[model samples]
Target: MTRQTGAGAPGSPRVAGAPARLAARFSARLEKWLEAERTQLPLWLPVGGVAGVAAWFWLPAPAAWQGFLLLAAALALPGLVFGRGGRIGRAVALFALAAAIGCGLIWWKAARADGAALPHAVVAAFTARIDRVEPLPARASVRLTLHPLMVAPDPRGGAIALPGRIRLTVPLEDAVAGLAPGATLAARARLVPPPSAAVPGAYDYAAVAWFAGIGATGKALAPVRLIAPAPAGGPSLWLADARIALTAHILSELPPGEGGVAAALATGDMGAVTQDDNNAFRNSGLAHLLSVSGLHLTAAVGATMVLALRLLALWPRLALRAPLLLIAAGCGGVVGIAYTLLTGAEVPTVRSLVAALVVLAGIALGREAMTLRLVATGALVCVLFWPESVAGPSFQLSFAAILSIVALHELPWTRRMFEKREEGHVRRLLREVAALLLTGLVVEAALAPIAIFHFHRAGLYGAAANIVAIPLTTFVIMPAEALALLFDSVGLGAAFWWVTGRALALLLAIAHHVGSLPGAVTFVPTMSRLAFASIMAGGLWLALWRTRARLFGLLPVAIGLVMTLAAHPADIFVTGDGRHLAVRAPDGQVALLRQRTGDYMRDTLSELSGREGDEAIALDDLPGARCGPDSCAATLVRGDRIWHLLATRSPYRIDRPAMEQACAAADIVASDRRLPGWCRPRWLKADAALLAGTGGLAISLVRPAVVTVAAMQGQHPWALHAAARPAGAIHGSYRRFSQADEARHHSRNRWRD
Candidate 1:
């Protein structure tokens, strides 16, 4: 027996196998939660994601409680679905299909909702703190969310209410720049629905106001005064002040560049790092070092747990579950919440914080985190906490990144990476590099869809910059920032600030150098809604479906690729006197337009649009152009069609006879305004159906008609503008559908879009 046992131990390896087997069994048990979660958790993820958006669809026009209602519904779906089954595969499938249904239903419901065109308007006196004022040559835009106390609606509307729109602009750009978020001032202004005439079928002023929670809109119509003693107060205010103070303290000790960068990494203030330094950081893939995101949060948590556990170890009775785990979790929450508030409550920060809390809660409850319920719980908390974020980038991208990381963590790869024990730090260094690169790729790929749709530009070198910067920041820079800031308050911050400033300088230099390279960023223009949806769908399919189905995911990708290649705007406008045509592109819309032109617009369109090119034609070069002080126009001939371009509205109307001649011969007409006699004008953004030689003139509105005149019925000639009374003229169109035609097409019945 001894011989046999010795032989088994030496050859069969059963002696070592016992411990290995136990570890394997434990891991498998956790993974096999497929069966355990079969009932509800898995089903909820897809259901919940859909419910999230659907709830958005269900929001009331004027959006009263819509956010809360929809978010609740979405939050509830995951739990309902997850508990229905014990099959992992079945749960996943259920959720996947649920996701599809949710997406389609959301689109349909939103398309069919009650508020489309807003008939109501508000006039208010508002006071707000100036957050940031961005300046350009001609226009200076101010972003100020309203303060409740100062806003009061006129007697024409109900007394001033919640959701008043803030005054976004004031005349003076320079003075406002110095004003911080806590500053307050007041303005009396008229708030009305955004006219449908300017942009048909797009967001109306009222609907936009609702989503933004702005009750009224304002421009400085009266003199502004700074009310002294009006300062930031309350938890939100205190947190913000603390963040600023923290940043200031941190920069006091570090060397200049190093200090600045260290401060940014710690406090999310990238203001001091110059553009060149930023570029170098990017090329080196250290950009994440600048933002306090998942990595930052996780590192903080890890550090906290380690330190806390060591403290707890000193007390034997305290080492067990309840007290120890409870304290641990609370500490984690503190780190997450404090960091979130300090970072201005950015969407990503909230998302990560919620996610961290979910896992922590699971530990407190003595359960596993991999369960679908936690995911659902986290999502619901976020929506309930801040519905506005549901419509933004941070929540979406942060969750996706977290999900991807979770997926990889559930796989064999993570296990392998963590298995090795090393005598020195070389292998650890390699592991860190690998982890950073993998994380970068996953996050960038996951967010590419939303980023393209929303921001338009991709940080192609974001990964490279992160690799170098993250470590420098976590180990050396962040400490320097804290040290600098602490000393700076005592009139000693300069030395610390200088010290950290140098490190930042190095990283910034790297980022700038890399950013300057030929292909640092592959510029692409913002695409159509269809294009954005298709791209997102493609990405989703690639990410979610089984490996075998991934190839099929490329179908949408291909469509998006083709669309991106062929994409171009239908109309171009120029000022009559040969000045640049200022067609508005959101933050990054001018990418394609930029490719045709050179360095146009102020501030590179704010990194939102990635498309830029050099095919623009000079305003003067176009023939048959004339100019007036307010507007400019150039007559452009596309093929055989003669198109007269006009900009800057003139008080005088066009000559009736010439207008008649122009309308008669014109194959297609596009304008910023409706000309007289153009009544019952069928409108669309991209195309006009009025083909030459078919009927006298045809107009094809690419989208469904927002406003339509059943028959002229001999209304006033100014009725041309009358028909343009906005779609669902008496209601909020974007918030909900108000199809007048359906309402009146057949009397004695209710109507829905």
Candidate 2:
């Protein structure tokens, strides 16, 4: 009664207890969420690993010791969390540890992959042993993966050290006889360092090459002389030789256009496929069929298992003595492994093979297969070994598509809706079609953002196209090709080959027709990393979570799409070498400063601006543009300002006086040659000196700023080439491990160890 005057007021009991009640409620909710996500824990293990790999790639020049320190800290997290925190803390700690391990592994791989960087390009004669051979019959060339043995002395009277591996595009006439792996050859070639990104924030081919252990690329200048024939040894060599033979056999047996598709499906070689065909497939959403991935692997394994089971059933005594299912599973797994190895063992194929083998093992062990868990396991394994692949489109697209499909099937309602029951044939067929349609739509939606992020476009009709394309490729083309290959040895495969060709022709026709439909492709301007990241996060959330709370993921996804739509693409674009320039006028039309530039450059510019190459009009055709033989002057209006641009067309000598006057009057200048200080523009002077430092240039008048490739690509080992530095500045411990240098200096090659 006395406390009621102060602490114990009339409603004090309810108010004071409110805090405790809220705390209890919050704790209960968190525990409920945890319980709900209990089965979802394993899925996040790979997510953490992928996040770690992504962090490594995105961070600028991460030190090895830093990763080790992070690993140590992450390892200690579990102990501290276990002692002081609850289940949620323990889960977070485990996830942190997985991320740290992923980061550490990728860091180690990157360090190991580091090799000598070529200071500058040089055309010289070199001797190298071929490590691999890729036939590009469509391009009238053969690509050789070479291990450099010797290079002729440079013009400055010094030996040139080549990297451990280099790719040379040898013309059909320049390629030597028996130009296969394990053969040594001498050739004149233009050896150059890996090319950098074309524009700011574009794809970094240099980084990809670096991770692949390819330090340089070149084109053969003259015919190569084979010093030695291919040795009849090495498993990789045998595979390469066999792949070449298989590709040739497929192409030889089938008709021309259809054979390229056939060979691609059979051997995972797309060199024979023409650019037009590739584009058609890509636009029609049938491009995945060309890539030997989970679909092909599953089909092959299933076919083999069915055939094995049928054959084993014929031998009733043997079938009784052994478990037929286990035996069939074993046979299927063996055939799958063989096929994977035969087809180059690419990342996607290997990932599929791993999952297939796991499923087969589950069958043999009489265990239920958890599809989503199996996908997670395969992804985690691939991330552990090929961490760099996490950054690639192939890895992202394949995993995203599969995860979405599996997650769709994992939903309770989805299972109920598709549950098998006694029904008429028409009902069953309709149910199957509906299931396929739903799956295709889910996969397409999941893959759209990724496709747009990489290709700057998404196929609108992909799902509809796949309804016809998939069954044609799977049930007809794959099985026919398999039978054709089997019967080829007995010289009775002609009929099967004809069937295969007809199926492929129909597939290609479907692709072309679908691709030609109006609005088949939706082009999007280049999106920012943040937008892409948000989309990725939301997609993972939606795919990983099984509860209704997963619907919350749509918030970030919608935000990302809005951001992408509201983005403002740069109005001015310049190549890294300053040899090309493009300007987008106020009317939303683009014009090229040079009419003579190649199609590749034009296409690149068009894609970046979210337009087709054919849609870009000539600079001279623009209303406010005037042109001459060696230069062009243009005016662009953005917002309230009028900007003037002067761009030189020729790389050779220009009229210096006229250029200087024009530069003084213009707001922006672009030239391939080094310009004098007096020729400076008011805003930008994109001459050789400036372009060398910037790498590439993208100017946005709306933002009134410029973005450079060098700035976007941070100072990584692969990007050091883009930095303006002396040629001799690149001589470091990394180059000391070069095979060519080690042979002469007789020093330790730590890379080998």
Give the best candidate by TM-score: 2
Residue 620 error for model 1, in Å? 3.1
Model 2 C-alpha lDDT per residue in residues 208-261, reported as the tens digit of each score: 888888988999988999999988988888889999999999989877789889
Off by over 4 Å in 2: 1-24, 61-85, 725-753
Per residue, candidate 1 scores C-alpha lDDT tens digits across 259-357 of: 456656676666555454554554444554666777677766656766687898788776754477678777877877877777776666667777777
lDDT of 1 at 713: 10
Worst 10 residues of 1 by lDDT: 690-699
lDDT (C-alpha, whole model) for all candidates: 0.49, 0.82
Q: What TM-score against the true fold does each predicted structure earn?
A: 0.63, 0.92
